[model samples]
Target: MADLVTPAERRRLYTLLSPAYLWLMVAVFLPLSAMLFFSFLTDMPQDAPDWGVTLGNYAEFLSNPTYGTLMAKSLKLAVTVTLFCILIGYPCALVLAKSIKGRAREALFLMVILPFWSNSLVRIFSWAIVLRGNGVLERAINWVLPFDVRLNLMFTTDAVVIGLVHSYLPYVILTSYLALQAVDDDLIDAARSMGASKLTILRRILLPLSLPGLLAGAVLVFVPVVGSFMEPRILGGRMGTYYGTVIEDQFVAVYNWPLGAALSFILLAVVIVILAAASPVLKRAQT
Candidate 1:
């Protein structure tokens, strides 16, 4: 790879990559290092005159079960959303990749991925409008049914789940579609020639081959969803409190920067562990 590039080409590559690396070092790494340092302190140095390093924040988390429960709730939410995304998105991907063709397939695929082009905050809020009491969803239901029915989904766990699923569904679909699309139609036809049913082909061929991409998409959705705060707050309302919201409050509402930093660092560590666990499968997919 190195031998293929001229000195000028190498210089151009270095020039393009250097700024990104430098930006990561300054913007992300430096702040993260500072946050980690702050997490061990008794108080933020800016506010407290006699600040000192301490393990009190971590100790607080252990001593109080509330934080642990909230973290558990967050993990549960992540798992639920990931499962739903896989169930719903994978089939959509299969249809787009295998069932559809030409311009229509392209159009549908574009529609599937179009959500990513818009702001996520806007999307979540739109769900809130649709799900709230007597909102668009209820009205639509009422219009069709003989009796008036109220589907007050806002400020509920279900709403949170819906919002999250809608937001991250594209991730699973995009990855799964790419993986399934790579599968040759000839292989599937050959399976049919052997008198294999559709379900059998999907189970034996499509699934095994696409498992890595599915797992990759799950990881993509789960990690960020675990750390999500805004969607829960907007869609779940009073019932929206989760680990992410707690970390957010520690910084913004409570102004306990140390505790916030500690929580944030722990979340980052958990995310790293998750990615590390999934790395082997992702590498296998590439091969």
Candidate 2:
């Protein structure tokens, strides 16, 4: 197909991109380009009509401890949530893959995914209700227990982590389950016949064999977890001073377009760096 396109066809294709491409460039890429341009501007307030070109935004971000701390916290939260998702999701996927089959498996998968079918806002609100001091789930737990106690599960870093893990767990399970399903049962049978214990088979065979799915799931979980705002806003309370909130405030409330753009681009840089660092590990796992 690439070889078949003549000069005229190429010109026609470029001509066809005139309408939709213009909109895309205007609505999406142009703003992004402007953001990148303004990120280097200086000698002007964020809303100034004529902003001069400089690297002040980049320097300020680098020199300011507050932004630095926020970046670190966001990264740490993302890592922790990703790890939790992997730990919980791996076992769940393994069980589903090994035992369930046909409609039962499909049903179980649906159950895992059902939470995601509704609006994410609803999910966050549902968690808020459950995690509140006297929420239904807490009340139910109290009823089961012999003593009365208030569980502080809401408005903390932990709650945000839980929400993120819950939100992305399905992706991990689906990816890992697919990988587990593709594993050869004969390999396990052979290992067993050769006097390998169940634990050894799992640690040595299963984990290694399931690496690709695990990597895929990890990427799916981490990328979005780092950028999540609603989960933190509803669940994080005072401690939820996440960078996403900062970005939101800058763009929406303060209307500091240049600074917000700078912050957003900085975030993109951070994500790119992390992905680049992890890419080798992911690729090796696939191999």
- For all candidates, what are the clash counts? 1, 1
* For model 1, the run of ten residues with the poorest summed lDDT: 1-10
Alpha-carbon TM-score of each model against the true structure: 0.90, 0.87
Residue 283 in model 2: lDDT = 83
Question: Candidate 1 — which residues are off by over 4 angstroms?
Answer: 1-17, 274-287
Judged by whole-model lDDT over C-alpha atoms, candidate 2 comes out at 0.87
Candidate 2 residue spans exceeding 4 A from truth: 1-31, 42-47
For model 1, name the residue pairs that clash. 155-236
- Pairs of residues at least 3 apart in sequence or in different chains that clash in candidate 2: 40-54
User: lDDT winner among the candidates?
Assistant: 1
In angstroms, the error of model 1 at 41 is 1.5
Best by TM-score: 1
Q: What tens digits encode model 2's per-residue C-alpha lDDT throughout 73-171? A: 998999999999999999999989987879998888899999789899999898999888898778999999999888888888888998888898999
Backbone clash total for model 1 is 1
